[model samples]
Target: MNITIYDVAREAGVSMATVSRVVNGNPNVKPVTRKKVLEVIDRLGYRPNAVARGLASKKTTTVGVIIPDISNIFYAELARGIEDIATMYKYNIILSNSDQNAEKEIHLIHTMLGKQVDGLVFMGGQISQEHIEEFEHSSVPVVLASAIEPTGKIPSVNIDYRQAAADAVAMLTDAGHTDIAFVASPLKDTINQHVLSGYYEALEAAGIEKKDELVIEGDYTYDSGIEAWSRLQELSSPPTAVFVNNDEMAVGVIHGAQDNGVHIPDELEVISFDSSRLALMVRPQLTSVVQPLYDIGAVAMRLLTKYMNKEKVETPIVVLPHHIEKRGSTK
Candidate 1:
């Protein structure tokens, strides 16, 4: 037989209202009463009816998370963190992939809203002004995870890409590598631009002349990485070191270099951002910048919960810290 709130209240010798307060995690009840009610609840194996509870509170207790690509290890780990926290808070998550398309993002947002999600978490390349305007009219709260727009009006959780990239480049330059190449995704995206800018700044600071021929653009894909590596090798003078934007492409670059009879960390050193599991799977292993992807997702969910509860959050925009993981990929 399923246990009910009435059973918990009767067992605890408290009124139904007191039991309700304890179950809802309300702090208004006395500690003794709360403890007693919790004991009764645990002993009886009582489970709160989420649907009824939501109706009574006028909240769905569901958060919608929209990520650019679910298959990507970065987003996958982030979703795991978000789901873990949501479960801890007795909330469910509705997850979707947007493919980093603005139109798809917009459509997913509307779909999630229509589903009556109490809050939203979005992760992508760049959220446009039009998207922000549309969200402003949304009744539910929305938070950005691992994404940032220039306006800085919306709440977001991300690391300083520019600084992280700069640090990576600086590490190579410090290792006596003057011929360095930056392999990045499309610079049209805001996040990619920040990383590229960091690379440029680091090179300029190191007094290393920027070579247009050395910079290669990839779509953050393994195939793109291979193609970019081929193109870079075809150049009259190939770079001694390469900094890739992501681990997937970095792996591709490594393989491409090997196929071309290049030795890692000797003939060609490679490093990338996003310290994913793939970093360790490689032969020499990839040295990468570790972005707190899970923390970003968890914190974004927490902030969205606060917003849903009408609570004041200290900071709307959260910049998480990142660090480089030194490995065999770079000298």
Candidate 2:
């Protein structure tokens, strides 16, 4: 078992705060008490730096990063930013993919914490009550990147997902497209739910009634986008435009339409979230909501450092800015 400051404090019959002062050479501690704490720390082979390294000029601690899917371009970009910032801070990161599985995610949390990571940065689609509880009870600070916990108890960084989705759908509405379709991801996660809510809100604002047939759910994959197109064509009156939840699926929708001899931006307008590289790779480049993936990860890692250092954070929950990037996919 890895010994921690808590162990040293318990053995010394002192508070963790008192043990901290002794470790940091604070003059406020009584000399006899400090000597006793030091003895306990030495006997227990406790390394204070692992728990409290805020005063150190050079940090060599490791932080854990939990990503839903590192293979996805969206999460890959976010991870890149996190890695760069971790390098700059002289800290290493242990990255794990949960595959969006609740049990696996919970397991990873316990395993990483057992390793005594100085902090944690998590990115996932769903944040369950159990996940929040684990994070709250964690010995190390936890920071969320592009994830939401409804209780707002955990520190996190994200853009206004609802507003961003609304903005994307509104663009299609502004183009006088009333017969619009939404290619959405699974609504199990709050993020996708926010996107779906925005889509409906935009239609309502444009005085268009929500059509049950016009909405199709995708699995955030290119293949799913293709499959969604097949479903939409089965409708008697196919939508004239589509708002996709992510760029990969949007590209699939575009290709699927083109394969059926449909002219993009002329026959069907398309807009998607996550202006990732996939957006620009297509023939008629995708118009997308700029989510600032890298920035979100970088900011999240920076925020984690603040908590690890016990620094005062003015805003524990950070909301970044987002905008629409119009391209050939949208008229």
Candidate 3:
């Protein structure tokens, strides 16, 4: 059902390079050989890959998209933005999931590069030194979307995660809840670490000592939020308010509390980040830090296009704005 250059070459008893040369309109091939290749191509219904056709012009017109998990709503929306912009610029997308694994991330980078994509848009958590080295070595341009590279060496798009976390914690404290808890993502993550730091800063500002029992690490999942709440319920003095890392986990925290017959806001107040659509999908709604997820993805793609097209980019690191979405989740 499909044809390739190799099929044409084998059918015509010609080399692959010869087929390439003929397809590219290179006059170096003999007239007879060119005509034979053309006939084979036509008879085999072999349509040249558009990217291959544009290679002579030094453009593949295709971009690789590396995301942590396409199943995640946050990344899915971001991917949509990237794909939409890429389509506008007439670029095809090649998507792959790294599953937030470092080794897999590196492997995907190499794989995408091997595909000869003109550029890449990457989204992940905790970009490592190895990632930095790989991006530095890439022949094609790479832009990070809603991801962080601690060294600030890579071109990326994100919001001020630390400040956002601090603001959310302050709001919880301002409501007269001294026993505030922090539901965090993977502790190793740079953004999570910053968010945790902001939480501590908020506590310190109010002259509250950090409580080791109040901090729980979650995996940015509803189940984790539920687990965090379960753990909090065991504490001698459970928190009256909590700062959750994401909406999914925040929802879990709420349900976790309700499952145990604990009333929300009346007994526990919850605030979350990423003001993703999930924030609004739950009952009583979620109060969260609104992130420009689509804009981050769209802007990252545009920045990558600029690099791929050899256009000038004044700033490599782009930090989008973030705001808190006040809702029923918090008092």
Candidate 4:
């Protein structure tokens, strides 16, 4: 009652080796042979035994993806892209959340490696030297997706955060907003530092004196954004426009301002990064930068696959493009 490779081969009038090649997705098989073998396999309801095949070939044909938070729309969309591409390549994905903790991330890496994943796609706020060292010694291929490690040795796919942030600020300045504020998470992270630097650079270019009072830090959460707005409002002269590091915080800022009787765009303009779905969900849709998070994840997975196959990759670092999507939040 159970069907196997032998049944498929016998039905197709082909040798077992030829059936094996067809099942493994080999391109050398002639089209007619492939079609005939597939028809036989389908008719017999024979399925390839992935576990047995992996034991023989030492490859699981699976990818492990680790992200900081899947609740965030940005990361959720990114994971979708990775899954789509992995499915295309006949591979499966094992997804996990690291909560952006370095120790937890390292532990997850070891666990995934123990499971013998063919490759890994990692995304987090900060990657420590220990992580880099572990990855350097890893037998499997690893790629950073929307995350940057301190060491530039690992392959990565991301947009130019510094440039993207700078461009957003420049746009705000050109729109006649002289007084601006930069709201971000901790600057200890390298990516956050680059974004903040861009904000400062744009202000300098526009001849606007940088005000320390206007620079506030949030934890990239909606609650933290509310706190940041409260702190900014207490200042002697509040900023007319604010650049938030993420859409979650931007939503909080918008709501917080409205609660304090401040009108968006007319009284206070807000811009955030990562044009996630939440950007459109807000009452006054957030004007934000598009990070192309999905593309970053997909490309990183592709690069890891190439590395796993011992193929030459064209580039170690792939920088995707980003742009601003204007909406109701910004003038």
Top TM-score hit: 3
Note the Cα lDDT for every prediction shown: 0.89, 0.92, 0.89, 0.89
lDDT of 1 by residue, 200-229 (tens): 999999999999888889988999989889
Error of 3 at 300 (Å): 0.5
Write the residue-wise lDDT of candidate 4 on 76-175 in tens digits: 9999989988998888898999988888999999988887889899898877788889889987889998888766899999999999999999999999
The window of 10 residues in a row where model 1 has the poorest summed lDDT is: 49-58
List runs of model 2 lying over 4 Å from the truth.
1-60
| Candidate 2 structure quality by residue, lDDT tens digits, 166-254 | 99888889889999999999989889999999999999999999999999999999999999999998899999999999999999999
How far does residue 180 in candidate 3 sit from its true spot (Å)?
Answer: 0.8
Clashing pairs in 1: none
Question: How are the candidates ranked when ordered by TM-score, highest leading?
Answer: 3, 4, 1, 2
lDDT of 3 by residue, 32-131 (tens): 9999999999899998886666666576788999998998988888998899999988899999999999999999989988877898898888888899
RMSD to the hidden true structure, all candidates: 4.8, 7.4, 4.1, 3.9
Among all windows of 10 consecutive residues in model 4, the one with the lowest summed lDDT is 48-57
- Please list all clashing residue pairs in model 4, or write none if there are none: none
**Alpha carbon lDDT of residue 111, candidate 1?**
95
Residue 276 lDDT in candidate 2: 90
Q: Which parts of model 3 are misplaced by more than 4 Å?
A: 1-46
Poorly placed runs, candidate 4 (over 4 Å)? 1-52
Q: Global lDDT for candidate 2?
A: 0.92
lDDT of 2 at 10: 91
